[model samples]
Target: MAVSQTADTEELMTCLRIQLYHPEPQNIFSSLPMDNRLKQEAEDPVRLGRAAEACPFVLNDTKVSRKQLALMAFRVPGSTEMRFHVQNLSRKGRLQVNGIELRHLVGAELPDKALIRFGRYEMLVLREPGDSETHFEVLFERRIVAPSQEMGEGEARTVPVMESEDVTLSWREPINEPSESDEYQNC
Candidate 1:
């Protein structure tokens, strides 16, 4: 249908058309107008470069040290037991985080008290599990955006490994219980 070449077409209708139900999650990471834009190819098709902060990293309490934490961003007072895949670029080791990981915070409904935190000349997440968003001083250091592909060098392997309801934090394989081989031990 050759639509009208009229002077006016409703902007809301145009927006709805663009908002078709794509299987992929919506990009909630909107940046300021002045913020420059760049493109990167990561596990997700294409992403904003300069606006890396907009990628939507969330954190919970105790999952990180109170000291300098870089390459992390955002915090939330939350619940709903969740797991997150965080990009850690620090000295490798197991670390305790008291709340849900930030990776899973994507597309999450944020609380009124939730505030984003960035630290260590980069960015990290801060979380408070009980949704207690009182006047907590959410301090963090701003950092330059690191390319998603450029992983920092570390001797230890760090990734999300979840067991039990309480998420135990670790930088390397725990020396105590081996992750496997206990299968047949019960026999």
Candidate 2:
């Protein structure tokens, strides 16, 4: 009887983790900050926004609303597979998942791997299997674009250009003689 109860408890367990992901740091000595990572249970919904009292995962950006979005976990009917869904709660901020936009109060099923964008933030969501629990990782990234520099009078101005790594050129030989079909058409 106790074994069956334990199995039931384990089957209901779900774990979720969120971390700030940096694709490539300009400095090699820089390391990932521990304060940016968070862990929570999937049974309860996770709220993200600028308010610390209402949301456990708080974003300090002013552009984020009080409750920007919520992540909810659900189990597939007739199957043990677990999946996650995201809902946009903010009326001012737009939510995007895998390039698909969600309006206010709109929700959508999250893919196994997805790129989510809200305001100036981007998150990579990944679903992975765990021992005795369903595990999910949300890698968060803040998109920051560098501003153009202004030059004073009599100073030279230069713009930065990015070079492409994949550049291909194809060359074909031209035919001097006309084909039989061209001769027939002419006649």
Candidate 3:
């Protein structure tokens, strides 16, 4: 029983990690808290912004426009196995990879070691090295109690486990191809 519980806990471990970086002025290192539950519950495309109260990963880029949505991360569809794709959410700030603008690229594959910059902030996207199960399910256990010497009440039943699957707002648009732009060239 203990071994099975341990395996379950390990299964809940984070599969992906997003590291934050900034230039000389804002040199800070931080990792976003990403868990299996958050990934499983998130919509197709995950939204990110600067607003602490709004975005899943609240970015602290003062140079970023307050009205901009910042960025969007999503899992590629049409296959059982999928990789993450990142796109710029703001039209003002360009998402650059290797000093090249990402305005033309459909979506940059994540878990990439290339330097990523937007506004005054830079980021490194990485994945944890481990075997992970793609299937996700929530389990529930129920229990019943009888009135003998334990309880004064006649008969009582309790739900020891409960699973919730309510879908919340992810503030993300459906993953799609980028529009044609003559201004920015492909990187």
Best by lDDT: 2
List, residue by residue over 57-152, the lDDT tens digit for candidate 1. Answer: 222223332221222223324743222223323233222222323331122222222222223112233332322222121222222343111233
Clashes of each: 17, 0, 0
Candidate 3 residue lDDT tens string, 1-187: 3366555345542234444444453422222342322443323344456655655554455666433333333344564333445666665767654343555223455442334556655444443333233522211111122111132222111211112242121222434568877777767
Give lDDT: candidate 2, residue 105: 82
In candidate 2, what are the lDDT values of residues 68-109, reduced to their tens digit?
Answer: 889887776776666677888899888765555677888876
Predicted candidate 1, C-alpha RMSD: 17.4
Error of 3 at 130 (Å): 6.1
* Residue 48, candidate 1: C-alpha displacement in angstroms: 6.8
Model 1 misplacement above 4 A: 1-48, 51-79, 88-120, 130-187
TM-score of each: 0.19, 0.55, 0.47
Top-down lDDT ranking? 2, 3, 1
Candidate 1's displacement at residue 168, Å, is 5.4
Range of the 10 consecutive residues with the lowest summed lDDT in candidate 3:
140-149
The Cα RMSD in angstroms, rounded to one decimal, for candidate 2 relative to the true structure is 15.2
lDDT of 1 at 63: 30
Screening candidate 2 with a backbone cut-off below 3 angstroms (N, C-alpha, C), the clashing residue pairs are none
Candidate no. 3 TM-score: 0.47
